[model samples]
Target: MTKTTTRPLAELQADFVRVGALLKQAREDVETLRRLSMAEAQAETLAAELEAIKRQMDRAFADEDKAKEDAFIAGIKDVRITEGDQRDNLIRRTFTVAVTRTGNDGLRDWETTAEKTGLTSLKPEEYAWLLRHPDRIPASILALADDPRTAFQTYFSSKKRGYFRGA
Candidate 1:
C-alpha cells in the first residue's frame, strides 16, 4: 500500500514563487560573470596593442634623431673646409704695439706685442665661426695674436694703432 500527501494550495503557491525568484537570481549572476570575463579579455588585448605602438614610436624618434645628427655633422664639415680655404688664401701682415698692464707689484708695465692684420677683410660669418672654434683657425693666423677673440676683434677696429695698412 502507498500513502500520498498534499499541502494547502496557498502554501504551495508561495513556495513556487520563492523557487522562481532563486532561479532568476542565479541566471543574472551567471550573465554578470560572463560580461566581466569578456571585459577583462578586451582590456588585455588593448594593453598589448598600446605597448606595440609605444615601441614603434620610440624607434621612429631614434631614427629621426640620427638623421638630424648626420645632417648637422655634414654641414659643419662643409663649413670647416670652406673657412679653412679662405683663411689659407688671405695675405697676412704683422705689426707691433705696446700693451700696458698692472704688474704684481701694483705698477703699470708696458710690453711690445706683435699683432696680425688683414683679419678685418674676412666675412662676418667666417670670423664668427673662427672665433667660436679657435682650433679651426690656421696656426699662422694665431701665431702673433694673443687669442682667437682678440684676433677676431681686428675686424671691428682696423684703425687701432698697430693695425694700419702699410704701417
Candidate 2:
C-alpha cells in the first residue's frame, strides 16, 4: 500500500480549472485595458504580460492532459518504458579460453582473462546484463571455488559507471 500525493483525476481536474481561471482573467484584463486611454507601448506591455501568463496557464493544462493520457494507458496495460545502458559510448572487447571442469589451473589470469575473454567500456545496464547473462562468467566462476555472487559484484564497479561515492 503506497501513498499517492496526487488524487489522480481530481487533482488534474483542479489544475484544469486553475489554468482556465488564470487565462480567463488575463483575457478580460487585456480587453478592458484596450478600451482605456493608455499609450500604445503601455498597452503592448500589458498584453505581453497577459500573453506570458496565458502561456504558463496553457502549459499547466497541457501537463494535465498528458497525465490523464498516461493514466488511462496505464490502466489498460502495464506499458512501461525502461531505460538501460546500451554502451553507446563504450568500446567492446572479447575473449576465448581453454578450460577444464575445475577451471584449468593455468587457464587465465583475471587481467589476462578479461583481455582474452573480452573487455569493453559499457553502459550501466550493459554491465549489469553481461554479469547475469548465461553466456557470461557467472556459471564459470562457480567451478573455481570463487563466490558465485562475484559475477554480480564485478559489474557494479563504480569507475565503470563514472560515479564514485564521497569523492
- Measured by lDDT, the strongest candidate is 1
Clashes of each: 0, 5
Colliding residue pairs in candidate 2:
94-117, 94-118, 95-116, 95-117, 95-118
What are the models' TM-scores? 0.28, 0.24
lDDT tens per residue, model 2, 1-167: 99778668988999999999999999998988876656777889989999999999999999997676554333121111122243432122122322211132476633211211323333333343343443544333233335534533443353366543343
Worst 10 residues of 2 by lDDT: 75-84
Which residue runs of candidate 1 sit more than 4 Å off their true CA positions?
A: 1-4, 48-167
For model 1 the local lDDT of residue 147 reads 89
Q: What is the lDDT of residue 18 in candidate 2?
A: 100
Supply the TM-score for candidate 1: 0.28
